[model samples]
Each structure stands twice: as structure tokens, then as C-alpha cells.
Target: MEKAWWKESVIYQIYPRSFNDSNGDGIGDLKGITQKLDYLKDLGIDVIWLSPVYKSPNDDNGYDISDYQDIMDEFGTMQDWEELLHEVHQRGMKLIMDLVVNHSSDEHAWFVESKTSKDNPYRDYYIWRPGKEGGEPNNWESVFSGSAWQYDEATDEYYLHLFSKKQPDLNWENEKLRDEVYKMMTWWLDKGIDGFRMDVINFISKVPGLPDAPNPEGKKYASGGQFFINGPRMHEFLQEMNQQVLSKYDIITVGEMPGASVDDAKLYTGHDRDELNMVFTFEHMDLDSGPNGKWDLKELNLLDLKENISKWQNGLNGVGWNSLYLNNHDQPRMVSRFGNDKEYRAESAKMLATFLHMLQGTPYVYQGEEIGMTNVRFDSIDEYKDIEILNMYNEKVIQGNEDPAKVMQSIYVKGRDNARTPFQWDDSENAGFTTGEPWIKVNPNYKEINAKQAVNDPNSIYHYYKRIIALRKEHDIMVYGDYELISPEHESIFAYTRTYGSEKLIVITNFSSEHVPFTLPENLKLTSSELLISNYNVDKNEDVSSFTLKPYEARVYIGK
Candidate 1:
């Protein structure tokens, strides 16, 4: 297998709208990111993946891009973006911009022209079908709730919007549209940007005939993913993209691919595959969801989590690479979701970080995750801003047969907004995210858990992350070693080992609040084992004989 730079690098995901506000406009901008380059560098990040900052209508909070080549007015100008890219490269770091070509905002020029006249040449740039009888063309459901088909009275046709109605899916079957997309991607690569994080790139291709999916509940709406995700011509499109644009530049590309199986992942990222370097799979991320993709608020079993991770690790061992992550803009905080957020927040956050970073793949740290930030709670659904959450609240709480308060509680605990809140920089007003009112409310726990306080405390999650990243760079095994799950049968603890050459690292993490005694694996000698890192303050020479692990404690030991 070829050695890819991104394979051995740690990528940090930055949600631009919440990272930092430089112009006092209640929104983060490019300049703010430039100012924070030193912070990222100090944290030992090798690649920075900035979420969508392109021209948008904010319908899906920048995901509904209106222009691919231009920067959004709120983020900054094109000049600012160029300067930021230069700064990142100068600091020995790479920049990966979000490539959201699956759909475009309804305000985009192509969509505007497509909706103008039925005979327009650009009409084929988007999916358009005549209404069925007196209703929508199909019973497909938008990811944001409601019908995926939006009726255009002018043309008497309905357009497909897998997400919000304001965002319409692009017609990839058109060769002209594909060329345009490739041209735009090459333009960005020509500008010296490191690479791209393809947004729902697999959803760009759709099954032919636009067939109506079987409605399990006889409801008018359900995810149309079955008809679109990883469509028939997905590989062909990706291979063409790689040959025309990506192959020209030695840049990293990670696709946001959902509903992709292990075999499908091999097709997209295998050594023989030229489609992508890696892909973000949602198998582990969707553990808490119900059978119908709705919130169920169930507790995650540690053994099940380990099994899930082990399957991906072992399945992709020799075939493809994995993009490991605990939290992103679309998911809640890891500390609050996977780890204990109330009593042992700091310890559990660091433990979770240790577990993820030591995995045998590229690791992504979402902004504010290093400092143990958590979910946000609001009094009403009116306080929420995410389109998915708002739509779910309306469907399940306002219109369906579910309790509004219970639905709101699920939203508070598992909604994407929990991770979208402004970065908590200090204990000051608005968590020091902006001088003006923030676009979203800051987490109330910011007063006790902010960057300002963590930076000065040696026992903070922020410093722990810095140390682990430093360790990864110091030891080559941490980056390219093979992973092996050791204590898979443990109920409340997860243990794994990473080995490369003569170096071996054993990582043990307690996933519960109750202290548990664990016996060392058989034949594992401790005389030569050196304690590398621990969430708790333990001396290097501390005896391990019958040692009992405290709640949420994690330790990494290095040996022959």
C-alpha cells in the first residue's frame, strides 16, 4: 500500500461559524482562524479541516452552498481565504475545505436558471419531474423532514431536495454539470489548498427511474437514502473525478459517506481504489438512534461499542483506511455522549481522547473537544437553530404522537446543535466567542470548563490532548501501528494494543463511573512495561499489583 501523508496525520475539524469571531459580527470569520493558527500548531494538529465557508444562504448553516468558488460574506472575502491558506501552509499545516457539491442552495445561479423555464438548457442541471396527479412527483422524504420534492409553480414541476427545500440536489447524470464541478474543484486545488472533505459526496449519484420507496409506516416521508446513497454510478463518477482533478494534485480527500458497508468502503478507499483516501462512516456514530433513525435516548453498551469499533478496524485492516472521530458538527460532544459528563467529565473526556487517538487510523478532533466541552440545554425548541433538529422537533413533537417535552429532551441530549454552539473560550459573557450576541447560545458549563481555565491548569483535558498528540508524533508506532483488541469480553472496560516492530502500546480505559479491578492479560510481563500516559496522577514507579482503576481512568503502557 502507498504511504499517504494524511494516513499518518491528525486532522482537526473546525466549524467556522463557532470557532472564533474576529469582526464582532456574532459569526466566526477567516481572520479569526488565521489568528488561531498558533493555537492549532501548539496542539500538534497536522491538517485542519474547515467546514463549509463558501457562499451560502445559511439554510443549513453553510451546507446549502450558493457558490463554490466564492467565500461567504460572513466568513470573509476571497483574499482573506487565500491569505488563510497561505498562513496554514507557512505554519507547516495543511488545509482541507469542505466540498459540498451534493446539493446547492436554491439561490445558486444554476438552480435559478433551472427553475426559470422548462426548455432552458440549464434545466437539466437539477433534478426536475412533473407532479404526480395533483401531488408531489414522488413520496421521497427530505433528510430534514417533510417531502423531498418541492413544487415549483412556475414550471409546474417538483425539484428534489434530500435536505432542506432551500437546497436542491444537483443532477450528476449531466456530463456538463460534472465537468463544471471538476473545474471548480481544480480551481481550489490550483489555489494551493491542501485538499477537500467531500460533503455527502456519495449522495450525488441517484438510482434511475426515481422510484418511490416503500413506506414502512405508510407515512408520506422517510429517508430516500435507499434510492440515492452509493448509487449505481458512484464509482464511475469518483474515478472520473480522480482522473481529471484529484489525480493532478497530491491532496487528501475524505468523503462524508453514510450507509456505506465495509465492502463498499473498500471500493471507495481500498489500495486499488482511486476514489478517496478515506471516508467518514456513521456505523458507530448512530448507535443511539432508533430503528427509524429517530432519537431513542438509549444507553450505549461498552462491549457493543468495542465490538462495533473492532469490526471496522479488523475489516479495513488490509483493505482501506479509516477516518476516526468522536464528534463533529453534526454530532453531540463525546464527553457527554460516550463518556460521563456529570461527575467525571474531565477524566472521561481525556480517557476518550486517549482511546480514539491510539486507534489504527487518522483521528479527527472537532473544535472545543480537546477541552471537554459538552451538550447545551435550552428551555424551548425555539432556541434551536439546526435544520435537522428543528424539523425533527416539528415532526415528532408538534405534529406526531410523541411528547413535546420528551422530544425536546432528546434534541437537547443528541441534537447537532449541542456541538454547534459557539466555542467556549472563557468564562466571560457569550463564553468569549463574540463581543456581540452569538449566533447560538454557549454551553452553560463554560464557566467551569473553558479554554482560558484549561490552558493554565496542568490537570486539564486540553493539556492531556496536547500531550497525547505530542506522543503520537514522538512515536512512529502510534501513527502506523496495527490495532488488536485485547479484553473484548470486559463489560465496563475497553483494552487494546497497538504494535509495530518491537514497540507495543497497551491502552486500558474504564468506561463506567464505578471503580473496577482488572487483571493483566496472561503472559504480559510488567517488568519492562513503562507507564506512558494516564488520566489520573500516578507516579511512574507506582506498583501495578492488584491496582484498581478509578472511575473513567485511562492508562497507556509501553513495552517490548
Candidate 2:
């Protein structure tokens, strides 16, 4: 086994637009992030994974990068970004930028030239194909709905965009494009930043000769995952990237791979593999996704959640590392999605935190998660700012003639804007997010769930997170321990144990609102166990054979 700085660190993801506002321009910028460095420092964050701040047309909320070298005008100038990097380093915290090279904005110079003409030298930089039989090149569907191929009148061909039409997929088969990407990566690492969180990195390499995906529902378009995810040359390309740029730096790299598997993850993040340090797998996130994928909603299966988490932990143990997270800029808040967001909001939030942070991987805390920020269900679809939500509503309800209320219900629960809403800082008019109008509506619960109140209250979720982070730093077993799932068949209890040499830790979480009786495994004894952390106050001397845990309760016991 090996020890790395990244394995011992905790990452905090900051969605810049929703984090804070400094200029009161209704948008958060680099200066605003600098203003809150001290607050994050107090929260015990070691690495700050800032979402994409590159120059863009705002097509996919900055994921569509038009310029890799420049900062977005809305997020402040190059100097502001420089000061932010310096300040984060000054506080002993590392900063990692989002690497969105899987696709570049259609407005980028490469794409502009690529679409100019068929013979253009840069034409090979993007994936373009002639139409087939008076239709698209393939039956593939865009992640945002409709055909994945967009007709370009200028080039007399269609370009592939797995996401929005404004984002064009890059041709990774081109050596010149790969060289340019590597050079751009080196330029950033040389600029004194940490590393990158690669956006859809696994989708970069595609199978030769684009093919039609299987249509299960007989829809007009099909899921292109079979032809794109972890494609033929993914490892080859990543290794070249590592050899050309990443290998030269002491930085961490995490790939945002949507459809990758445990076997694929091991190859990508294995210690011997010259690729990324870790990867984000979405098996756990997809537990609630129904037949038609994410848009088709279904109730979350608690036992499935436990199985998925435990599988990852066991599969990656000693092979590669894992990146633990329940919420991000793209997903609804964890407390709102997995826990009771009404009565047991705080309790369930703490319980979920205990379950994730005590695992055998580095944990990520999305901004405002420390205060149990729940989902926001705006009254109408027009109130939504996320392109994905709006597109789904338009396609499903407006065009497909589906039930309007039913579609809205899915949007309310799964919309990305639920997490993209401005961070609630106080009880001000705009939740202290901005004096001017916020880019998105603030969650109305901010008055009672802002950071100000959490910071002041010792028993708040914020402080509880702080204490859990401190314990991780203090315990070597947290990072190096071997994990085992206990009672994997338990429907309401998510329980696991971590053991490193003689040190052991038992983490039990009640995921339901009803009281449940918990019986420890016969192999485990608690005579010498010390309560390390718990969401609810518990009697340590109570009988271990039959203990009833309150609703949404979590307890971590440390044993010698």
C-alpha cells in the first residue's frame, strides 16, 4: 500500500456562480471566492475544486469552454484568478480547476475553423459527418434531448455534440489536437494551480466509425454510451497525457466519467496506471434513475445505495482510490434527495455525512452542504435557470405531450438548478448572496439555514462536519483502513466497518424516519469502544445486542 497527499486530503467543490458575489453583479466571481477563503479554511477544507471559470458562451454553464487560457469575463479578469490561486495557496489549501476538454464551446477558435470548410486544416479537430439517408449521421441522442448531431449549413455536414448543440465534441484521434490539449494542461500546472477535475474525460475517445446506439424504447434517438464511454483508445490517450504533462507535476486528477464501471475505474486510477489519481463513478447516483434514464424518476432504493457504496469501497480497496460525494453542481442536495428535508433535514444531513466521510476515500463537500441546503422547487418551469431542466420540460411536456405536472415533479426533484441556486449566507433579502438580483432564485429556507446561524451554533451541521474532518486528519485508519459491509441486506440501516491493523471503526446510519432496532455483528464487540461521533446523543453504556436508533441517526464507534 502507498500513501499520497491527495488520499489524505478533503476536497470542497465550489460552483463559482452560486458560491458568493463580490461586485453585486448578481453573479459570483473570483474576488468573491477570495473573500470567503477564511470561511472555508475554518471548515477544514484541504483542496478547493473550483468549477469551470473559463471563457464561454454560457451554453452549459461554463462547461462549454471557448478559451482554455483566459478567464470568463463574468468571473473577473486574469489578475483576479491569479490572486485567488495565491490566496488559496497562502492558506495551505490547494486549488484544482475544471478541465472541460472533452468538448469545447462551438464558439472556440478550433471549432470555428473546423466548421469553416471541408478542406480546412482544423476541420479534423471536431467530429463532423455527412448526413445519411436524408437524416442525421446516426441515431444517437444528445444528453440534453433531440439528435446529438447538429446540421452546420456552412460545412454542409453535421457535428456531434453529446450535450447541447453549442458544445462540439473534440476529435481525440487527431494527434495535433492531443498535443494542443497537453500543452494547455502544462500551461495551467505551470501557473501554480494544483490539477484538474476532467469533465466527461472518458467520453473523449470514441470507437472508430461512429455507430448507431440501441434504442430500447424505440425513441427517435438512442444512448451513444456504447460507442463513446471508455472508448477504444481512452487508456492510450490518458497515458500520453500523463507522460506529456501530468507526470511532471505533483498534482491530483479526477475524471468525471458517467458510464464507467468498477473494472474500468481500476484501469484508470490504479497506482501503476499512468492515468488519473481517481475517478467519479455514478452507479450510486443512478440508483434512483428509472428506465428512461435520469429524467425518468423513481424512488431511491436504500439497500441498493448500500450495495453500490460497499461495492466501490471493496472493489477499489488497495487497487485504486475513490472520490466520495453525494451532491455536486449537477445533482440535487443530498439532504433533500436522500434524507427527509422537512422534519429531519439536519439530522439526516449529518447522518449522510457520517456515512460518506468515514469511508476509505477522500470526501468532497459541495458548497453550502455543511448547512443542510435542500432542493428548491420553483413554482413554474419558467422559473428554472438550468438548460437541462428547461430542455427536458420542453421535450417531454411541450413537444411529447406528456403530463405537465408529472414532468415538473421530476424537474423539481432532479433539476441541476436546485444545487446551482445562490449559496445562502445570511437572512438578508437575497440570502446575503448578492445585494442585486441573484442570477437564480434563493432557497426560501435560507433564513433558517444560512451559514451565519450554523457558524454560531455549536451543535450545527457545519460544526459537526468540521469535527468529522478533524477526526479524519487525526486517524490514520480513516484513510488506510480496509472496509467491509455489515448487514448488506438491511433495508433501513447502512452500516460498514473499517479496520487497519488493530484500529477499527464501525459506522452505522439509519436512513429512514422510523426507529429501527440494530444488532451488532457477532464478530464485533463494543466493550472497549469509544464513541467518536454521532448525529444524535447516545448512551454509550447501553446494551449493544439490541439497541433502537432514533430516526435518521448515525453513530461512529472507534475501537482498539
Number of the top lDDT candidate: 2
Model 2 segments more than 4 A misplaced: none
Candidate 2 deviation (Cα RMSD) = 1.0
Candidate 2 residues 9-48, lDDT tens each? 9999999999999999999999999999999999999999
Cα RMSDs of all predictions?
1.4, 1.0
**For residues 264-375, could you state the per-residue lDDT of candidate 1 as single tens digits?**
9889998887899899999888787766564887778787789889988878887899999989999998999989899999999999999999988899999999999999
For all candidates, the clash counts are 0, 0
Native-referenced Cα lDDT, model 2: 0.93
Using all chains and alpha carbons, the TM-scores for the candidates as numbered come to 0.97, 0.99
Instruction: Kindly report which residue stretches of model 1 are placed more than 4 angstroms away from their true locations once superposed.
Output: 542-546
Residue 198 in candidate 1 has what lDDT?
96
Q: Kindly provide the TM-score of model 1 when superposed on the true structure, using C-alpha atoms.
A: 0.97
- Which structure among the candidates has the greatest TM-score? 2
